[model samples]
Structure formats: structure tokens, C-alpha cells
Target: MSGDSTESDVAQETTDDDGPKTHSTSFKIARALFGGVLAFTALDNFRKLDEMIAFADSEGAPAAERSVPAISGSLLFGGLGIAAWKLPRLAAGAVATFFVAITPVMHDFWSRDDDEEKEQHAIHFLKNAALLGGALAFLRVAQDD
Candidate 1:
């Protein structure tokens, strides 16, 4: 405890024009957990490319064939970057962009006629909203750094 902490225990600190900021172990864990989830999900999407493309098309996504791969790639890159604290700004921005671009379009709960489907889509939309918040917070952290 007196010396440098291990990866899990390490707390990163950085200073900016305003003051100093500290990234706690909890923050790092949160980043890793969420980032890993996104990364894994992207890989899975890639594995089921045809299925994902079809889903995207069903969701009324334009140019689903091209956009699906591009989005998946960005997700993978952003997730890995954030988890590893590499290119943190770009990573966080990518995540934010992904959420902003997809949440309303893909999870259009308001457009659903079935109550159950609407509720499901609503939940997904809210979840993406929360994740977008996290991405913004991470972006701020990166900016401080």
C-alpha cells in the first residue's frame, strides 16, 4: 500500500487548469466492465453479421450492410481504447456518438404499436441513455487528463 498499487488498485490523478482530478479504482472498474461489454457485443455482432444486418434493416437503418460493420468496428475500437485508457478522448467520443446515432433510431419505442414491444424498446433506449452519460463522464475525465 505504501508503494505503487497494482492495476486494480491504482488511482490515476491528473491536473488541469481548474484543479486536480483523481480517477478512483471504482471508476476504472466501471470503465473496464462497460467497455468490455461493448467490445464483446461488437464481436458478437460481427460473428452474426448477416443477422445483425437484417436486424438493422428491420430497424429501418439506411445502408445497413455498410453501416453495421462500420458501427461495430467503432464500438470495438472505442471499447478497447477506453478499457485500456488509450486514446481516451476518441474512445469516449466514439461511444457517445454511437449512442446518439443509434438510440433514437434503433430503439424507437414511440413508434411501436405493441405495448410490450414499446416497453422493451423503451428500456433499451433508457439503458443507452445511461451508457451515453457514462461515456460523457469518461470524456470529461479524458479531457482532464
Candidate 2:
């Protein structure tokens, strides 16, 4: 073979060396930090299935029991996939979908009558918006890759 490094050789060099590896390591940490929360929340949803369903029903979601579990499962798999860098696009899409679909419906601060309740829901809504932004960013990054 010529002296010119092969793609695998360059990849190996990056992995073996600290310069590029630091960036990679940081990205892995970022993925874990973002995805971990979703995974943990999903597990909590499963653990409190009845409460989740009741909350969904209270929000007037159709078929709360079924939808809750389905969404939770999507979040679980999506989060793990993101952290592991497996099926990244699909995972990011799933996470994005959850935030887009649930945020307005579930955390409708405008619908709340009590000031404190409205503020609480508003906080949740903003948090979900931030999460959705992250998911969309990952989705774009996955597409670029």
C-alpha cells in the first residue's frame, strides 16, 4: 500500500491520539447528559404508569393508557439509541416527536386558571421546548454525518 493513510488508519490514529479524542469524548459525554434524562424519565413513566395515564387523561388525551406506554417506550429506546449512537436519526426524531406532540397539549399554561399552576406549566413547556431543540440539533447532526 502507498504511504498515504487509509481511512481506517486515520480513524485509528484519531482514536489513539488525544487531540481528536478529546472532542469525541466530550461529545459522548454530551450525548449521555442529554439522553440520560429522557431514559430516566421514561423509566419513571413506566414505574408510575397509572399516574401517567391519569395525568394524560386529565389532559384529555385520547386513549391515555395506550398512548402513555407507547410514548414512554419510544422515549426509552430513543434515548438509549442516542446515547449509544445507534439509529441516531430515528432516535432524535422520536424524541423530537414526543416534545412537539406533548408539550403544548400536556403543558398548556395558557389553559390554567391559577397563576401558580400556569407558571408551573409554563416552566415545563419551556423545558420541553429546550429539549426539542436539542433533539432537532442531534437530528441535523445525524443527517450531516
Candidate 3:
């Protein structure tokens, strides 16, 4: 019958249309770039490990706690980078969260009195914060779809 032919055509059209697929090429590249940046940061942290430890001690870090942040940061940044390469938005968000939590504590602006030094530090902080913000923004945009 004509009705049966129309129903069959509808069924064939429905079968041709597949469900949503979730691969974003832009997101993948963003993730890899963010991951690479994190990896580089981790490398820089390791390169200045002893200086970091000394600063931690000078700032009254407990002997037991002094090495912990350094060790954790080195590992975390490095690991997050690799993870981001595989899972960009999630990894970027995770890394940014850690940075957001620790940056102020580690670089306490309230304690510094020198204007030039403060300005220099503030500029660097803002730059880093902007980078983190961009990573988070990318994550959000990628997730929205």
C-alpha cells in the first residue's frame, strides 16, 4: 500500500541519522597545548626545587611540610599535562583549581611592602592568572556543546 511505502521511507531516513558524537578537534588541540604548558611549568618547578625549598623554610614551613608542595607541584603539573593531552578541559580545570588555591598562599601580597617588587610580582601573577583563566574559558566553551 502507499501508506506502507511512506512508513518504510520514514524508517530508512531515521536509520540514516545517527546519534551525537562528542569529538571536538579544536578542544583536543587546546587540551594538548594546555598540557604542554603545564608540563613546562612542572619542569621549571623541578629546576628550582632547592631554591623553592629554601624559600619555604624561610617562610616558616615545617621541615616535614617544606618539600611536600614542591614534590607535589612537580608531579601534579607534569601529570596534569599528560592527562590534559588525553583529557584537555578536565585536566586544565584541575590544574587551574590547584593554582587558584595555592598562588595566593605561596605568593602572599599582604606581606610584601616594597612597591617595585610588589608591582613586578603583581604583573607576573596577573599574567599567570590570565593564562589559567583562558584555559578555564576554553574548557567551559568546549563543554557547552
Off by over 4 Å in 2: 1-23
Can you give the lDDT of residue 49 in candidate 1? 99
- Give the per-residue lDDT digits (tens) of candidate 3, residues 1-145: 6455475654553343442122345545655666666666666666777776776666555561545455447446534654345454565566667557555655565567998767766776777688667667655543542
Q: What is the C-alpha RMSD of each candidate to the true structure, in Å?
A: 8.3, 6.9, 10.3
State the lDDT of candidate 1 residue by residue for 39-109, as single tens digits: 99889999999999999999999899999999989989989888888999999899889889888889999
lDDT of all predictions: 0.86, 0.87, 0.57
Instruction: Report the candidate with higher TM-score, 2 versus 3.
Output: 2
Which of candidates 2 and 3 is the stronger one according to lDDT? Answer: 2
Model 3 Cα RMSD, Å? 10.3
**How far in Å is the alpha carbon of 77 misplaced in model 1?**
0.6
In candidate 3, stretches whose alpha carbon ends up further than 4 angstroms from where it belongs are 1-29, 59-84, 141-145
Candidate 2 on 71-111: residue-level lDDT in tens? Answer: 99999988988888789899999999988888998999999
**Considering TM-score, where higher is better, how would the candidates rank from best to worst?**
2, 1, 3
lDDT score, candidate 2, position 141: 66
Model 3 clashing residue pairs (backbone) = none
Task: List the candidates' TM-scores in order.
Answer: 0.84, 0.84, 0.59
